[model samples]
Target: MSPAVPIPEDVREEVLSLAREGVPRNEITRRTGVSTASVSRICGGPDGVSFDRSATAAAVQARVVDLKAARIGLAASVLDDVQLARQRMHGAEDNRAFLDGAKAVAALAGTHVRLVAVDKDDSSDTEAAKSMLGKLAQALGVAAGEDADQAEDGGVA
Candidate 1:
């Protein structure tokens, strides 16, 4: 019989890296010149090998999604607070509080968009957020970009 095919270690590593990067098995096989069976064997075997860079990128993307969701929720909460404060406003101080809450809502909205961009790793989201934030800032008559920066810096904006 002819000799058995042996998978090279470098090719195995490349396949594992591609897989971790969300590349499909067949794609990895094509890119790395490895069989799909070998790629599966390396990535799914009991040895538990991993491609750390791609795994970490995936994790960061997941966290970005979670953060964006939290930011949207927070924006909704701020809107409610603004409405309540507006209803209870008795004077200029209360009006200021309402404005501040509005600013908070805008900031959170910007953050939500930014997180979405980061998660997708796409410039399109960034451009969309910028355009949306500009319109929102104009409608709210507040400095949303500054507010977003402050919120990100203070961890509570």
Candidate 2:
């Protein structure tokens, strides 16, 4: 939708009214009895979808910030009534609610996780090393030790 293209005054007004309210183009077209072409023109061509960094981009970037802010606010509010937020032994439901709220607080306040990368493990060398160690230990009359006490498990001294 290219807003740059001129629409008829009536169509332009109608489009703006519906658009400001977040109405879908199809709905706008249906309601206004206007063609999709007219709606697209009033919307600023789809090809020229310009998101001003300070506006649209900022809004997208701050979405998480907004969500965290809301979450923190709600988490705080959940405790305003001290009685409800208080923990009582044998109160599984209340405890669960409190723990859930605490988790939300932790999430909003903590350093969240991020995945770095994933690579395949080449275990041929590790297996070969382990086999050599077991053979050497057996030849030396030393206990190769339990399966859990292997090099890969960091259990070998």
Candidate 3:
């Protein structure tokens, strides 16, 4: 058998840091240039460290917060577009201008509707928010893994 390679302490610590931040093991391996086996061993091997789930929960919450901010900014931009379209329509001096402005307003309104829609099955952000909620619950010890799964299915958990 080949001799085992010894990973430096700093590298192992980096691996643990990434895991605590909710980074996947494969991604940690890729980013740190470490072997997958080494990364896994550092993360949760028999002698490895058990990290605080709260760090992961915090990371997920941050992502959700950032996503919400981006959506708000986009909604504002769409509203501005709609307002411009309305002004153009009102100030139109000819039939063609009015028609173009009307079309712009219709398209902007549709985009705004889509941005604000919260259909769970069709919205990826809804799913991400749900996942963040479950992770937070788990971190807070409010629900075990199976209980969280049941809660997602609409059963009491």
Candidate 4:
């Protein structure tokens, strides 16, 4: 007969699923009733495992979907707070109060908003990126190039 499998496939798969789902390693240990050593082995040795090379890659992918959904829910909940901050910013009784509220709003927005700059140096594209960017910015009600920096820097645009 073949030598006994160190960790049964089903058990290993279960351990991987729990780890990818954001469960703490200790909790996974308790839940799976597997020894700490086994958990460590399955999750990759001491340094931890890379998702690409790990056996639990599929489970990790599933967890990514869950993480994205949680992020959407959190962003949605923050909408109400954002609206309130706007109101507070508008209704400040003094300059200091207004500045406080404005700062809060700006800081909060900074956390959730991301600016991505995609530079495509590929010469194969026929159209110039600068012109395309300009059009896109205008259509989106934003300033282009230098004007964009001015707007973001609080200058009248």
How accurate locally, in lDDT, is each candidate?
0.70, 0.59, 0.83, 0.71
Task: Rate residue 98 of model 1 by lDDT.
Answer: 62
Top candidate (TM-score): 3
Q: Candidate 1: misplaced stretches above 4 Å?
A: 1-52, 90-157
lDDT of 4: 0.71
lDDT of 3 by residue, 1-157 (tens): 9998888999888888888887877788899999877787788865465545586799999998888778878978999999999999989999999999999999999998887763236577778999999999877785487689899999898
lDDT (10s digit) by residue, model 4, range 55-156 = 378789889778777766666556667788989989989999999988888876665553111122457443677778878878777435667788889997
Question: What lDDT is obtained when candidate 2 is compared to the true structure?
Answer: 0.59
Q: Model 3, poorest ten-residue lDDT window? A: 116-125
Pitting candidate 1 against candidate 3, the one with the higher TM-score is: 3
Compose the digit string of candidate 2's lDDT tens values, residues 74-152: 6555444333423332244676766775555454333222111112154875798899999997966554455436765
lDDT of 3 at 77: 96
Which tens-of-lDDT digit does each residue in 51-139 have in candidate 1?
43676689999997788788667656755665554454433366677676566656655655554454365578689999999898796
Query: What would the TM-scores of all predictions be?
Result: 0.30, 0.25, 0.51, 0.41
Misplaced by over 4 Å in model 4 are 1-55, 115-131, 134-157
How far off is residue 90 in model 3, in Å? 1.9
Q: Report lDDT (Cα) of residue 101, candidate 2.
A: 59
What is the number of backbone collisions in each predicted candidate, taken in the order shown?
0, 6, 0, 0
lDDT, residue 100, model 1: 68
